[model samples]
Target chain A: MAGKQLFIVTGATGGFGSAILRQINLLYGEDAVIIACGRNKPKLDDVTKGFAAGVKHISVDFAERQGLKERCQAIFDLAAGETFSAAYLYNNHGLASDVTRLAQDFDDSAEIEDYFFLNLTSFQVLTAVFLKNFSGVPHTCVNISSKCAVVAFPSMSLYCTGKAARLMLYKCLAAENPEVKVLNYSPGLMLTTMTENFHNTVAVDSTKKTFQAFKEGNLYVDTDESAKKMLGIVKEGSFTSGEQIDFHDC
Target chain B: MAGKQLFIVTGATGGFGSAILRQINLLYGEDAVIIACGRNKPKLDDVTKGFAAGVKHISVDFAERQGLKERCQAIFDLAAGETFSAAYLYNNHGLASDVTRLAQDFDDSAEIEDYFFLNLTSFQVLTAVFLKNFSGVPHTCVNISSKCAVVAFPSMSLYCTGKAARLMLYKCLAAENPEVKVLNYSPGLMLTTMTENFHNTVAVDSTKKTFQAFKEGNLYVDTDESAKKMLGIVKEGSFTSGEQIDFHDC
Candidate 1:
């Protein structure tokens, strides 16, 4: 009980996110205190029911800008008065941009601001509070980044931009703090609802064709496999701090 | 004057923006229609006062969310019913981040949102409207980028994150629209008020020392010279679309 491990996973009820939770439960079992965060309360509750570890679910809508700080603070407060041997934060929550529109079609300031508020701002706030709260513990921070973070995809202007911004933010965080271990993990294109929506709705022909090929060839990565690989990387801890590690690279 | 050039420069009152304006004025002279945008009306008027070209000043506060689309639309409306041999958008406006704090210190949602509104959101909006309005013309869009876009610096998280996002945004734009010439120009460390603020207020010692060396060794690039090189790059039409051309790379 004194050497308990802590894990906080955002977007924990989603397909890839749930895989991560399962991987943690498999790896750490009763030694872990898993805090799973998702917007849907019933879904979150359902997802954590099978885990062997003590799992706590927090209903958090990252899109809502009001009381965001307080919300983040509440997340950290869950571990109050308890000392962990190690803490892990998997920053896995983000929404895909409106893919039906081209890059130049985004002329509305309010729309762009709203997109970033959920993707980047709330993400940053959560990470900051996590780091502050777990200052004494050896913490590992993972940004569930994407291949689009480094490569440009047509009709994914907002998603690419947000990912790139997030990667840089984590890089800066790593540079500023040498104590914490940071990893920008680009989980390969997995067969998730998000990817399904992207395949169906992307406006550009070239981009659509690429996704079409992936689907036809059945080349999309398995969510559970990719999640397990990421967990393996974390266990090995060979990645350079602040570097982006893609799924295929392993 | 039938094949006259159109040049739109934002942050026109600032040091680098003014230099770009002067370079365009020198290159095109009376054959250019220049739209200079900045928040300070008097300063904008003063900056364009000496230009030999036909210059128009638009007072815009990119930070303000209210009516931002209308403001960007107003910029393009100035070039309505006008045809040009080549139209250039010097997306040269951006503010430095608050360097007095570390990357993990930015926990407030509104503060982060406000910073990006000025640095990235308005920048994207302005570029989108510019490209849409000038669709018929041979358009060249330049995002006045920084080395920070690719490299993370301590105590400069917001600036680096914003630049990285903007760069990826332009990359997507270039991919989506191959007809438009796109360039991400990283104007090297220049002697400007922005640099002065950064050099003075940066919280990290390593970052502060690097700037100190630049200041002590007189290693900062001249704003006018760097601006001219960027213009020359535009004239040469040599860089790969969406690639970042740094100051020393030439």
Candidate 2:
């Protein structure tokens, strides 16, 4: 048990994040221990309680600098420990733009900063920290991306551009480091807070229509289904590093 | 003429930026006014001195937010003025990462933040500003990218990821707005300050080897050559919006 299988999850309180945690537990059972990270401690605790292998809840605000660095250090220390395991990191935290339209009178600069920080910068930092600190256990990372990375849409500039950066980051990591396996997975349109809460997220008419369509079942995938599909990719061991597996394709 | 042709350029002090400015002047002469923007006031003035139409040198630090916002607003105000021409905003500003390896002892957070700010945020802010303030004259944005955007690289993570964001941003812009012509051009190993200043820039062995190869005439295109090739793209008018034009291919 020296090198146990440990799965590290960010955004563990979110729909897809929790689903992925559940799936990992279901598949690996007692073999997998989860390090579930999120801002909401109570929520993360609630979500991980039922899992058999159990979860180590890490309460860290990714948006805050000190907290993020501390959390990252903790994770690195864990990875470098004697009892540490082969790690699988799922970078699942992200949010859509504050406004659907760029022309909005609100703080566009702040929005852009937030989007890049949350989606690209933090991920980059964490990846760097992880890769630099890895001792011997096998490592893999899955970056939760969107189809917006492939097809940039109107009113989706911030999300589109940020997700695009995320995909490229994963690609670069996989290409540069052969030892680490990485995946940029677009789980399709999920019925998560990012999609369903768009009524509160953006005020523009164009995006509102799109969100309406999502609600009306014109398009969207359930989180659990995609989570299972993603695991299927891992099970086959056929996913190459830097593979971008879309939900529809799976 | 109340509404003539004005080419807006960022990083007006750099090699490719200056070359493109000179090329535009050489081709269009008095017919094209250059809104040359850069940090160095004296350099910008010196560069634009001989041009007939003259350059509106906007000395603004891109990495600094307050100055950037003020300068951007000023540029928009100038563009909206009756004297301003049918504007063409050329986003030519980009910085190679300060170091080659991302896993350095130096501040990775600060490095990532600076790269995103200078390369992506400023470009994005300017684009949003430009598009939102447009008054119906032909406008095209040429973003100076690199082959790194297409190919991910080790030690070039910051540039690679940022340029990837830039390319995707152009794609999104072209997709969303049919009227705005956008080109993401990879200059293909230009012999610019970005290339020649590598010894002073990065301390990694891999990058040093690549730079040494560049120094040995094993690689790198001349700025003037790439500039001429790029102008050919603009003159040909066959290049589609959102098209990625590479120097060798062109």
Model 2, span A127-227: residue lDDT tens: 76666565677778889988878775665677778888888878877766788888888898888777766555665566677777777875778888899
Model 2 chain B, poorest ten-residue lDDT window?
A: B98-107
Model 1 interface RMSD over true interface Cα atoms: 0.6
Clashing pairs in 1: none
Residue by residue across B114-201, what tens digits does model 1's lDDT show?
A: 9999999998998888887766678899999999999999999999999999999999999998899999999999989999999999
What root-mean-square deviation over C-alphas does model 2 reach? 2.9
Candidate 1: TM-score? 0.98
Error of 1 at B190 (Å): 0.5
Q: What's the distance in Å from true for residue B33, model 1?
A: 1.2
Candidate with maximal DockQ? 1
DockQ of every candidate structure:
0.90, 0.46
iRMSD for each candidate structure, in the order shown: 0.6, 3.0
- Which residue segments of model 2 deviate by more than 4 Å? A75-82, A103-107, A199-219, B76-80, B103-107, B199-219
